[model samples]
Target: MSVSKLLSRIVAHSSDRIDTCKCVASSLHDHTYGITSDPLTQFACILSALIHDADHVGVPNTQLVKEETETAKRYKGKSVAEQNSVVLSWEMLLRPEYCDLRGAIAATDAEWTRLKQLVVNSVMATDIMDKDLKGLRNVRWEKAFSEQDPSEDAHVTTNRKATIVIEHLIQASDVAHTMQHWHVYRKWNQRLFEEMYKAYKEGRSEKDPSEFWYKGETGFFDFYIIPLAKKLKDCGVFGVASDEYLTYAIQNRREWEERGEAVVDEMIEKVKAVWEEEAETTDTFVDEASVSL
Candidate 1:
């Protein structure tokens, strides 16, 4: 299959978000970043977007690390999942039989280095559930913007910095829902919450979900996502669309909250059930191990 066709098939599982990403990529290429006009770069960006979270199991990196000790030890807490994805995705491009889209992406010395960095960082950032990773990203962004020499050519500087920043941009884009229309915002927020809650519940067997994990569809607008979107808008790098999206996010949170306590109760129950099941499994395992000894 052609790269675009492959992307379209993978996107069917995440049609709305992927379609939104395409629109964002086009707008960014034409109106915002201007770099996406390069077919190779555009392909890199789209491929990164399409594969960043492919087959995401809704599990957080930290949880994966704690549970899959061998995998964690192998990578020493590095991006085990993303690294696997990048290698697997690139290898897919190398099969001699799949030459249909070969060389459509540049494999030149400089271009390979740049595109690979972009793809790796973007995929790694999807582990938003890692507070350490998020903090590191914040620090890195602050350093990049603060350290860049504005008088020099941005392209002339080390591409590593530029690539990392673009990765941040893509991550911010994936999270751009907070800055969307209220109707659109609520739908995505719910999906994200469900995904996170699933992870949170799964982690309970090991430890309490980090205090940040929300147990209910409570006042998320007043408490979190809305304010977060506003903060991103205030950052100024994300442009005006992000600001508009944040406004709608606040509106969506309000509407969802108005749906009453029943919805919140249901969500909490679901999350709680996962925790309960995980605990039972852990206990049973412990009993088995003790008896074996």
Candidate 2:
């Protein structure tokens, strides 16, 4: 429901990833957990989750681009919400007031560099709707999981694996709603529909969410949610969390397929009534004020 919950999941996933890392991390020592073993990496992942949606405006990036808003222009129409979030939150973290906090996070120049890189990657990975980003993610996944040359350094293999894992870890956390229980999924799903419908009502969006929302959600489940959940399961790193995520994902998708249209209509009427109530409240306030004067 909140980014804080997402951060909690990030923490849980990172910990589980570490606990299970020895398997995919080239048989490293039982005490080791590859890149997550680095204290800074865990810090960076959690930090990324904390700030990933710092100023999200309940609208998708595509809507921002269509409107050509200042934020969209600033980010050149690419992942506008995500770029704005990173810049705003990252700059705040860099402020003088946080000098001590910054020091605690990164004591050395090398550590700062690694933390910044991981943070950027982790945060950006949340923009799963970006097509170019999806293409790149595929490449990264292949590179990280493919057979490594015997000549490659063991550390390099682990580092590659960890980087890709961190990216996917943050991404899964971003859409954790879709990978949760039916009630949780429905709650968040309705909220998202409300957000997009509000945008259409305000004329800030080109398409009416209701017209396509049910279909859109199904496609999303098939193409993005299920695959990502499966990735979590196949990676062999998230422990029981991955299985839970995938199972919930499939069930949510089924429920939506069976009853999504009814839900969509229900939401439309619900939002319409709320807006009507607000309009009536405003008109009554105006009438009362005029009479009083």
Candidate 3:
């Protein structure tokens, strides 16, 4: 699909999957950062979201690396998925069919280069596998928010602010489902668990995926999701949305604490049923193809 169309679909899907309150909260956050008014920054963020998982393989980078997949070898285990998504998306844009569209969007050579770099950097920033990126963001946050004078030389630079804001915007949106209503979060969480479980069953992952599913999710909320919402608030750009997300995340975590094991068991049953149905369908298709051949 064209980039614009893909982005539109993503927004629509998110609206359907996530609660309206959550969407409104995120919009308020964007408004606080003035993202809606800045065309270039806005475009970069939109592009990042559109291509963040353009051709995801339903597996994590850790699994790909463990299996020595071509992608892992190509990327040398560094942000494999993120880099692949950028490359694939860029390849689509560079195709002959997209020449006119590309030309219209990027009028000058420098503009095109800048646009490509922004998209790459923004997408790459989403790779949580890069430990240093989070550290840098934390350092920047402390300098910008913890100081008496944010304008001091030790604080975040204007360019750094632009980069980090865009990065955080895409990152937050990528996992927005986690901080939404319980139903919404539950649906996507199950899907992710199923994906990881598939990898584990295939012997690609290092650990028993099902064993720690509930505990891992709880820990994820405690260390990552909750902290992320707070960080957005701490940055002073998305306090309203951040607050809404933090509240929901806390509630969701509690709900999980009480019922997570049952939920995980239910999800496992659901995933098993779905997988069996899919296997049957695939087998039928293969038999039909063989007969025709």
Candidate 4:
């Protein structure tokens, strides 16, 4: 079985949340990018999305930084969620059952580098608040497409201009829902908001008194979505269908904003409930361990 299949199994064993990740991955591969040719690459992409949040514990990198968690201290605030997830994925990939995918990914040094960088880029892009990431990626993307390289080899070169563009493509896919069909965008936006609020609860102890998980605003669509949608539409990588898709996404987001806070409130309540249960279980475990010791 491929790593993707194993991932599905792992997700089935863990939680249904993996279902959302799989759906997003399939959408990105089929609908958004239309690059379903390479099984290995597609599998890698799915793995990137699936493992990106493995053992996530619903905490934000910022909270990890504030708490000085081991992962935060190790990655030095560089997308700690992404870095840890990638490492965990690599570890799982090395197991005997997963060796097939590992060998496929590491077939050549070039292939290894490409897969590693792609996974890193896609996973790291989740942190939209990283000001430096946006600036650095934009600079690299501008330099890359401006040069107009036609070679496949040129496109995958590590730490090069083309690498940046490819990374942005993956990053673009991560948030592609914001620029997709309205029905699709609304569903995904709700799911994403749930993820964010879950992260908020996991990080609440690290937050200031006045802080909330998310403010339920459309600022993300207005700022990031609008500019990136325009850029993608102009670039033409997504083809003619995407033009309509982007239009619907923007329209739907506006509608969502006007629909009031019902959906957002539901998401917040669900996350808080889950975290409360988790906290109780954790406390029980700790008490048991202390008594045993």
Q: What lDDT does each candidate get? A: 0.58, 0.78, 0.74, 0.60
In terms of TM-score, the best-performing candidate is 2
Alpha-carbon shift of residue 132 in model 1 (angstroms): 5.5
User: Order of candidates by TM-score, top first?
Assistant: 2, 3, 4, 1
Tens-digit lDDT track of model 2 for 8-93? 33223343344464453434322133643467877787788888888998888987887789999999998888888888988898
Clash-forming residue pairs, model 3: none
Clashing pairs in 1: 179-245, 179-246, 180-245
lDDT of 4 by residue, 1-293 (tens): 22232222221111223448667555434332333334545555676756767777566778788888899999998888878988987777778997686675678878877777677776776667788987877776675455555564633532354244344445556676766666676576666666665554545544421134134346667777776666655444344434654685678667767663665566556666876899999999999999999
State candidate 4's TM-score: 0.64
Model 1 is weakest, by summed lDDT over 10 consecutive residues, at: 6-15
Poorest lDDT segment (10 consecutive residues) of candidate 2:
2-11
Per-residue error (Å), model 1, residue 226: 4.9
Candidate 3 residue runs with Cα over 4 Å from true position: 1-37, 147-156, 275-293
Which 10-residue window of candidate 3 scores lowest in summed lDDT?
Answer: 6-15
* Model 3, span 50-149: residue lDDT tens: 8899889978887788889999999999889999999999999899999899877878888878888889888887887678777876786665456456
Which candidate, 1 or 2, would have the higher TM-score against the true structure?
2
Deviation in Å, model 3, residue 47 alpha carbon = 0.9
